[model samples]
Target: MNNIRNWLMGILAGLATVFLTVGGVRYVMAGGEPGEVEKAKQAFKSAGIGYGLAALAPLVVTILRGIVGV
Candidate 1:
């Protein structure tokens, strides 16, 4: 179970990193076009949320494990 948790955490963290990097690239490549900028901003926001969720997953898992007496 601990190994599974570690794998899941690693996958989520990797995905979050990918999202952040792609979003950053999109934002940088928007080139001042308003619509493109808005899209890039939304992507960036999603990346931030992904990163935050990834960062919180371990804490959440720990709390859940404690609650379930795992």
Candidate 2:
């Protein structure tokens, strides 16, 4: 279970990193276009959410485990 938990956390962190990197690249490549900038901003927002979820995953999992008596 510990191994599985670690694996999931790692995957979530990796995905968050990927989203953040892609969002940053998109922002940089927007070239001052308002629509593109908005899209890039949305991507950045998604990345932030991903990061927040990833950061919270361990705590969430622990809480769940305790609730279920794992």
Over 1-70, each residue of candidate 1 has an lDDT whose tens digit, in order, gives: 5676677778777877777777678778889888877877777777777777777777878888999999
Where does model 2 exceed 4 Å of error? Answer: none
TM-score of 2: 0.81
Candidate 2 local lDDT, residue 27: 84
- Per-prediction TM-score: 0.73, 0.81
The Cα error of candidate 1 at residue 62, in Å, is 1.8
Runs of candidate 1 exceeding 4 Å displacement: none
- The TM-score obtained by model 1 is 0.73
lDDT for each residue of candidate 2 in 24-68, tens digit (9 for 90 to 100): 888899899898888888877887887787788788788878998
